[model samples]
Target: DACETRVPLVLCGNKVDLRDCGGRRGGVASEAGERLARDTGATYFETSCKNGDGVVDALIQLARQMVTTEDVAVQTSALRVCAADQKRPCCGGGGRKDV
Candidate 1:
């Protein structure tokens, strides 16, 4: 639940490539998947790992949802945190200064 509150979530229905090849019924319908996504407050994706379809698109969509212009605006609105002894910034070259 903590992760849900802190991060954007995507509902992916993988293995779409096998929906028609074997002697098996198709998976959930697109309408059903969309309804599920609406109910869960998450983006839905029908991906096929076999042919690499919808994989990159889903990843890009999730990333865009997580990193938004609003978040950047809020971050830039706040005053920069300055360490007492540090010359540059809080996380600016702190670990790589010795390297």
Candidate 2:
């Protein structure tokens, strides 16, 4: 028998800080990322490893999605994990607050 489970997917655009720096532009456009995410049924997020922007939010959203994919009891446990993560700093000492 073939397993029919669908895993949650998230598409992250890293190094977003360099996307628009000084007079230079790089990295994939937000529209493109969103479009790809939509086409693949995945979530899109722009992140900056240097600044930690969108890091926590993406992680939390992934956790929430994972929770929803699980059974009720497992969902509850996973939600707790997400909630606890929100209390900590994003990436531990990145100084960015979690949402």
Candidate 3:
């Protein structure tokens, strides 16, 4: 499956703090990161590991969604299994097993 089809994605651009010190020209780093996020339908964050900018915030956001969505998926799967096991021959035509 494509990354965009997934429920949650975080796009992080590291080493933002080095731009000025390394003499890198333009705001291309941030712009390119945002463009990639937009194209992939994911959240974008610019961070400097040296200074810890936006790192914690981005990780927390992703973690929060992961925990919540995983719980919901587990519950849904359990429900599907229970429903499938409850199937009876008289409940449907031809006595086909529930999927």
- Strongest candidate by lDDT: 2
> Where is model 3 more than 4 Å wrong at Cα?
1-7, 26-28, 89-99
Candidate 1: where is the Cα deviation over 4 Å? 1-6, 69-73, 76-99
Candidate 1 CA-lDDT value: 0.73
Write candidate 2's Cα lDDT for 1-96 as tens digits: 115556889889888888779967866689999999999999999988789999899999999988877765576678889999999866786776
Give the TM-score comparing model 3 with the true structure, all chains together. Answer: 0.67
Count clashes in each candidate, considering only residues at least 3 apart in sequence or on different chains.
0, 0, 0
Q: lDDT for every model? A: 0.73, 0.84, 0.79
lDDT of candidate 3 over 1-99, digit per residue (tens): 133235878899888777787576533388889999999877899887789998998999899878887887787779989898778445566666659
* Most accurate candidate by TM-score: 3
Rank by lDDT, descending?
2, 3, 1
Error of 3 at 74 (Å): 1.1
User: What digit string (tens of lDDT, one per residue) describes model 1 on residues 1-99?
Assistant: 223244577888777777787677655567778899988888999988878988898999999987874476456545344333445755765566554
State how far residue 9 of model 1 sits from its true place (Å). 1.4
